[model samples]
Target: MTVIRINAITVPADSGDELAHRFAARAGAVDGADGFEGFELLKPTDGRDQWLVVTRWRDDAAFQAWLDSPAFAHGHRSESERGGGEAQRPVSSHSEVWSYEIAGGSPA
Candidate 1:
């Protein structure tokens, strides 16, 4: 069954652009991962401060494999950790991951 991982990032009101830019900077970073199905960065339209990073995988093992891969660590490293000068300030003040499966949906 397809598995979904949603990273719910909470940023300050003024940091949304920065968060998007950071995500854009590393766009396609996970494309080559095994069993990586798809990805989407969702921006909140209402008066909420939470953004969502949604990723779909072939299965839990696929997702776990990606998490255990070096690419995942590399992609998640801070700029400074990657040998850039000073580390940039974090855009999101809080975040969390929500997991789910395709319970039901119309055929696409």
Candidate 2:
């Protein structure tokens, strides 16, 4: 079954854009990983300090592999050192999906 990962971050109000950009760039670097399906960065329209990153993988194993990979660790370390927002605070969640269907222009 596919696995959906949702990471919610509360970035400092001043560094939200920078943090989001950095995350997006790092995510783009891993675009070719095995079982990597898609990624999305969601920003609040009410000008809040929270951001949501939604990622899809072929399965839990693939996602775990990526998590254990050097690329992810490196990116995480780099992001941590940037000192933007609540650097050490992040709320993350995971869900196991049996099936999913989308009828939009694209699915991510």
Candidate 3:
């Protein structure tokens, strides 16, 4: 079954774009991971401070593999080493992850 993993992160107002830029810089870093399907970064424009990282995978196991991949390690290492937003910026630390297994949906 296909799965959708949404990593919703909260950053301070005016800092969403900064976090977005950082994500863009690392785009495709996980493209080679097994069963990696797709990814997207979302920003809210409703006077809110929520940014979302959306990823689709073949299944839960595939997503779990990504969480364990070396690429994941490198991503974290880069964040700390570069003092990125998650480090240097005053973004809020609140975040949430939600997962769903697709039951039925129209193709996009």
Candidate 4:
């Protein structure tokens, strides 16, 4: 079965735009990764401040490989280097990941 990872974050209104910009810059970098099925940056549409970063992989092994890949480190390197900068500052509360296996679904 396909594996899906959902990383949800809550940030201030101002931070959401910044986050989106960062995501846009980095999202394409993951395109060539192995087992990378697809990706989505879900923004709030109902006046909420929540965002969901969704990624799909071939399987659990693929997802794990991504976590252990250089691309993963490269993608997050800025975060650790500066000890979290303005790019990460707006996450006022916290973030969490929700994973799921694609049991069944319909095409859009």
Q: How do all models score by TM-score?
A: 0.93, 0.65, 0.84, 0.82
Using TM-score as the measure, which candidate wins? Answer: 1
Give the alpha carbon lDDT tens digit for every residue of 1-108 in model 1: 899999999988899998888888788899999999999999999989999999999999999999999999988866566786667888898999999999998998
- Candidate 3 error regions (>4 Å): 79-90
TM-score of model 4 (CA atoms): 0.82
Query: For candidate 3, what is the lDDT?
Result: 0.80
Q: Candidate 4 residues 1-108, lDDT tens each?
A: 678999888878878777887777666777888889999999999988879989999888988988898888878655535366444444436789899987777986
Write down the TM-score for model 1: 0.93
Report the lDDT tens digits of candidate 2 across residue range 1-108.
566777767666766667676776566766877998888888877976667777788887888899899877666754556555445544332323233333355554
Question: Local error of candidate 1 at 12, Å?
Answer: 0.8
Off by over 4 Å in 4: 79-92
After superposition, candidate 2 runs with Cα above 4 Å error: 79-108
Q: Please, what are the lDDT tens digits per residue for candidate 3 over residues 1-108? A: 779999889898867767877787777888898998899888887877778888899988999998988788777454556565445544657989999778887999
Number of clashes in model 2?
Answer: 0
TM-score for predicted model 3 compared with the true structure: 0.84
Off by over 4 Å in 1: 79-83
Clashing pairs in 2: none
Better of 1 and 3 by TM-score: 1
Instruction: Pick out the ten consecutive residues of candidate 3 with the lowest summed lDDT.
Output: 83-92
